[model samples]
Target chain A: MKYNYLNGKLTIYLEEELDMNSCKIIRGVIDGYIMKFQPYELVLDLSDVKFMDSSGIGLILGRYNLIRLLDSKMKVINASKNIKRMIELSNINLECVQYE
Target chain B: MNENYIKIESKSRSENIASIRVGITSFLSTINIHFDELMDIKTALSEAVSNAIDHGYGQEDTESIVTVEAWIRDEEKIIIKVIDYGKGIEDIALATTPAYTSKPENEHAGMGFTIMESFMDEVIIDSKINEGTIITLTKTIKKRKSNSKKVE
Candidate 1:
């Protein structure tokens, strides 16, 4: 995972499978950045993610809540077809997610 | 009646999820299964394994073992069972509910069983208070036309 903070926007690049283990690691890293930068806009880039399950959804939702707590907005970009379907199956209102 | 089976036993650690996914998917790839179907199975399997490691062991007892068994029968049916000998679930019905996470503070959305059911054709859950929990996931693959007689 890689992240960049520019102006008030923070973009994170996630790679590989977002399973339980990777989510744990990624969550901590993202949370740290959120606390430090506290950006006005947070973006999650899933272009490099090869596999994702419900755990991935949980990760995104958790981050979304965290971003909201800081009065910031979050957006998910470049999610693959399977990842998008998984998100849809959850039936949760993640209006910020944009599929690729 | 093409058949293949594999059983894996590993510690209930988070890191073992990747290897388990690869092992099960590689075994299924012996035959002709669509990529989407393969991904669906993989996602369901990952959820089961995550439940075993996270909820079953309560994220503290990594020494406990989680066993994953997979079998492909008749070249079109696949069955996977994830077993964990840890603190078993008390209420199966409530646990399977969408977005009902026992650990809300820990960011657990509690969609493990829900995702498994959505991705697989059948999902069976059996748990005892102190014994263990077994999650059986079954899916029927529409065998595509391929020269992979290896399944036979």
Candidate 2:
């Protein structure tokens, strides 16, 4: 997975299954970017993500914490139905962001 | 039908996570469960295994084994167990509490037990301070009735 900083927003493109296997890398990358670039907002694009487990949830929540610390916003886009349901069950708004 | 088991042992490396996810999903799908139910099972199982690898094993290079067992009972209940022999949780009660994690530096949300409790019908954890841990979860499937009176 790779993340890019553009237009004052940090966009992360996820690949492969977002389970424990990829969390370490994903977390490291996102945190590094957040600290270095300090973007005004964070956007996680999950168009290519095929699977996500509870660890994935933890990863997102951790990012949410960081974004809050920076007084910024975070949004997810193109999440799969399963991922969408998981997010919704966690009481996050799905319509605020686009779903592909 | 009967007891079906899959075991994978590796160092505390994160690479083994994919295998664990695949193993649990395959076992659950073979029994003809709903997708939502399967996702719940998978999520809970992944949390358990990740805890074993990340917390119990400390994400070290030492050998750690994560064993998963699944079985169907009378075609009604599905049971799954995840076992690991590593640095057993010192405080089972506190460990399972939400936002309580031994390793917070790894960005641990400490919601593993919370997710497990929400996903599974029943969750039991057995652990010893220096011994190991075993987490068992069971869920009963609701049968769909196809013989309901037809609407005229």
Quick one: best lDDT, which candidate?
A: 1
Tens digits of per-residue lDDT for model 2, B1-152:
55555455555667877777787688666665777777777888888888888877777744767777777776558788878887788888898887677777776667788778888899999988668888898888664334557899
Interface RMSD, Å, model 1: 0.9
- Alpha-carbon RMSD of each model: 3.5, 4.5
Candidate 2 scores an fnat of: 0.54
Candidate 2, pairs of clashing residues = none
Q: Name the 10 consecutive residues with the lowest summed lDDT in model 1 chain A.
A: A83-92
Give the share of true interchain contacts found in each model: 0.67, 0.54
DockQ of each: 0.76, 0.48
For candidate 1, lDDT tens digit of each residue in B71-129?
Answer: 99998999999999888999999999998999886677778888898889999999998
TM-score of 1: 0.94
